[model samples]
Target: MAEKEKQEDYRVEIGGDDSKRSYTPAPAPSVSNSPTMAILSYCGASILMTLTNKYVLSGYDFNLNFMLLAIQNIICVVAIQGAKSMGSISYRDFKMDEARKWFPISLLLISMIYTGSKAIQYLSVPVYTIFKNLTIILIAYGEVLWFGGSVSRLTLFSFGLMVLSSVVAAWADINAAISSYGHDASETATALSTLNAGYIWMLVNCLSSAAYVLGMRKRIKLTNFKDFDTMFYNNLLSIPVILLCSLFLEDWSSANIDRNFPSAQRNNLIIAIIFSGLSSVFISYTSAWCVRVASSTTYSMVGALNKLPIALSGLIFFDAPVTFPSVSAIAIGFVSGLVYAMAKVKQQKVATTSLPVSSASSASMRDGLKN
Candidate 1:
């Protein structure tokens, strides 16, 4: 998930029919076209978080996905409170009104993470990484309709390539998996399933994740939430709902507990859960920061773009098939990301740079009219 926070001080100028507002950057010395550092921060934290999640879920011994989420939320809340006490970061104490407002977004986040865990349990990491790019289209158009954002033609072309890459990756993954059952016609027929359970969960995850990001982006601006506030509220408000689900949906017997946290791997599991929680603070902050400083589409694009390394790493570490078609698909994604980034930079530069000239002209005309 992502949110927009612009790096430069900018204002919306209302003009034209029906009071349509335009999002143009104000004339400022530090009118950066993009939040390069925030993008980097998100990429780093997001990748670390994803890899660790995959590691913990890879074995599927942990049956309770929501329980795991609850643990992480608990740790993150504790860490944030500790940091607040230490004066490292500060946010408004939990207000009922604000929590009421933020609760829907938290639910969306829970749906996204839970569905993602379900999907990732069955899908290869590389396929999951590539398919995530599909959310960019939804976000770009969502921004256009709801946030007064626009997508350039170059960006559209890049989107097409991204879609193609996902198709290729999915096809290659299925083919490689099916090849393992060669020389058996019955098995081949049975294994020809494309829309499996994992893919269904992945689709749900994509929709939920997109909704969460878009909703959070709009809500944060409306509420004037700082990054820390978003981080705190999302993690904090989610615990009760998650625990409630865990209560109903998960096993709590001592035998199940031992199975979930076996004695030998218990140390590793504890550390991973703690690390995931610690990193959530960073990931949440960076995600909100990126969306605020950048457009929602740009935030989504940059996150997917940065996944070039993630796709490759998933392939390397997860031992997914290293086929020619899969490699080419990754290459296509990389090139499209470059094209999209360049186009966004050019668009922002023109929009921001032209504002000063237009503002100056308006000012001069007003002075002449006064005289």
Candidate 2:
């Protein structure tokens, strides 16, 4: 899977435009547009996006996460509209039927982004990033339950490691907090409570994200929307929903621009949101380009490999505490992601080989002879 949250954020390059058609992997691009270059662009943009959002939510104390997301979505919608006007992209007009069909899945997406933001607000970047690994497992199991796919032994082993690492990481985080802040009973209690809340929200984030991914798999088929179309509809439809959520769920008095604008960091918050929006645009383009230039297999590997750099950057950039178990847990999670990536490659290869192309052709020829 791609490292990014939104599935429709990428433009998948395919041979034709049959909405319900199956996909065949395209050949890799040439040296000038190499997989390495694509992967680097994608990884860089994604890392920047993640760090920027974390800074906005945590460092800038712009805790109105839903509103921030709404702003981002608005930016995306404008960009898409402009691109359409400029002939840079093509998309279908919005339809009420499709909008109605997409409403429930959009709710799942909103939940995913909201809980993910809350998780980042409460947890360190490294912890939050590592916990995101659980999404892979959640989506995998969700496929097994909802799509009739069976889990293999390797997948089982990898997911088991991820689960174990999550437990160890949580324990390490709690202990490290106690060691650092144990002198003040009240502070220690607050730290413990925050950690607990962060983990709970992280779990919710994983489940909701998993649900969104799985639901989109079916929803996309029904809608027959390609990448740009999907992005347009998903973001456009989400604006109103996100606004309602921010209004009801958020404390607008504190998050209001009139109140926070007087603060010294107002300029900083503006800069952060601008950068966040630009980086999001960068990510959408680079990630899709990566998938187009590289194979999906290489894209998956890049996503797996990028986790280490993101984990390290979190610890270096932020003041997240370092501990043996926490470090070890990240390492284990990294390896598990690699395992999952390898498993995916093997499965794709198997699926390709298992296609009965020759038999289908032969049957067609026999029918032609009869005709």
Candidate 3:
């Protein structure tokens, strides 16, 4: 009996030991995966926006364009707040007071309006996308000059390549636009004038976009506001600015809703508006989600990737040209932008790891030394 009791006790101890050994802590959840999803959502939104521009705004005057964009931004504000509520996040935690430093936000609104209007006027969707990416190069140079940061020779070479590629793409777009108007004797003069105007507007758009990017980076870092909160504040601030711009700059007299479209096209326009609203919400939410998961540089690269699909879709939908040189330019620009992004990410990771060890680690090391 004594032997049996000892054996049972030993078995219980072994079983308990086995149970403890089998136990494993759960893995840390990955935040990086969310960025990939966010990127897809953003790309999807761009495609929807392209479709809206092509079909809905076909014969409408410029006033409608401004109004539609304002409406989209308004929808974005509401959607972002909805997303925050659903996610159980509080804007109060992000410190709204910091947004009072408004220069960057105002610049961003200006950039958006300038870029949107100019791209629609002068360049095809694909061409605008290729050149708009210059903002990234601008930001890099801005940092080197404004912040006294060191830039590698490779980065400069990459920028040069992108510039050369943009020239090639622009040449192709100009040729395509000219050829399309060749059959229309009456419209040729108008097309030429529009092209010149587009070029000028796009230049301003690029400069404003660059300034906005650099300023936002500096301001966000200084304020240390959460990404969601920054987005919310930016969208909110942009609403009033855009509204004012539209009210003054747009020609309301030309906005004849019924006359602009045929009976058959009216339904299509409504459908486009619905889709635009949905896409705006998706874009605002996913972009904020992406910033939370990945660094801003990564988000920017993903944004560049969105241009490819937009370009391709524009070609198919709007009968935009797809010349060899233009395609090559886009390919080179995208590759270089991606390379720069990867380099930035690597540098960021290195900087993060190189930070000093926590106080706990230092204390533990001292305790060991004393022991």
Candidate 4:
């Protein structure tokens, strides 16, 4: 009798049934956090936009950039719907019903307009293109300082490389201006201006973009919204903000609508419009997705990839002179930026894998005992 009782007790402990017991597996991590594919799309979009702007829209004046942005946002809406129909995840799960969620989106749209306009106005095409890398450095430091996270040494090295590459890429332009305009002439004085008026605008762009990323991260974590939902809301909020800014700041009454262009120019403008629109959609979506999957530092470094192609295209299309020093700088920057991005990815992967699973098993045992 005693032996039988002991056996029964052992069975109860193992099976958790005699008194009560149960088993429950922990919920798996959501797939939404893995956004590598999205990051690639963002990088691709950057390259496409650079190509179009350089080769196709050189002489067009139909507000092609604005038109492309509008079209891209529309396409983003369509893409979200498509994602939903395919039974992929969406933002509906977040349960957010407040109007306040749209604020950050509006800020982003305003920043884009201001930055784009200012870049065209004050900086040479090459300078504007190269300075964009500054955004990466700003974002990386912002994340570390504001979020209380430490940046890895590899990441810092990568940022240094990117900054170096950017300076090198602009070297050819700087040298040419010095040679043609004479190193000490007043007429050429503006050409040698470093971080001129337009650069200030780009700095604003960097800060606004950082705000968007940081704000959106907080919002998503709090609400548990899907990527598509966040994107949709952001785009929707941007429309009115863009329109309002255009009305007050831009000279809408003097807007030109003529399509007059040489046959070749017209063809190029058409190509630019299509490519720009596609790129806008790709970059906007992928960037947000990247922030969700990886740290801001990683995303920022990935953004620097645009400089390589942009610099090369400037040389090929505009006959921008390339020098040995400039070339070396570009190579160094690209390698460093790549290294930083790889390190970030490794860190994110480790973080995901480190999640505890034992708690779920304990909960299951307790439930079984209660039953």
Better of 3 and 4 by TM-score: 3
Q: Residue-wise lDDT of candidate 2 within 1-371, one digit each (tens)?
A: 56343444443665657654433445566764787787788788878988888888887545578888998888888887898899987889888998899888778778887898889888887788788878877776676787666567876887887787788778889998999899999999999999999999999999888778778777777887666666777778889989997899877784465554547777888888888877766777676677667665566656655777787888888888888988987898788878866776676566569963322111111111110
TM-score of each: 0.78, 0.83, 0.77, 0.66
Residue by residue across 67-127, what tens digits does model 3's lDDT show?
6767766776777677677985556343446656854665566565646555664567777
Counting only residues 3 or more apart in sequence or on different chains, how many pairs clash (N, Cα, C under 3 Å) in candidate 3? 1
Candidate with the greatest TM-score versus the true structure:
2
For TM-score, candidate 1 versus 3, the one ahead is: 1
Q: In model 1, which runs have C-alpha deviations exceeding 4 angstroms?
A: 1-41, 183-195, 285-302, 354-371
lDDT of each: 0.73, 0.74, 0.62, 0.56
Inter-residue clash pairs, candidate 2: none
Global fold similarity of model 1 (TM-score): 0.78
**Which stretches in model 4 have alpha-carbon errors above 4 Å?**
1-43, 53-68, 78-96, 120-130, 169-172, 183-195, 253-255, 259-271, 284-307, 345-371
| lDDT tens digits, residue span 142-210, model 4 | 656765455577767776776776677567556766777795697567766633555667677667655
lDDT of 1 by residue, 152-193 (tens): 888798889888888898788778767866778777655555
Ranking by TM-score: 2, 1, 3, 4
Order of the predicted models by lDDT, top scorer first: 2, 1, 3, 4
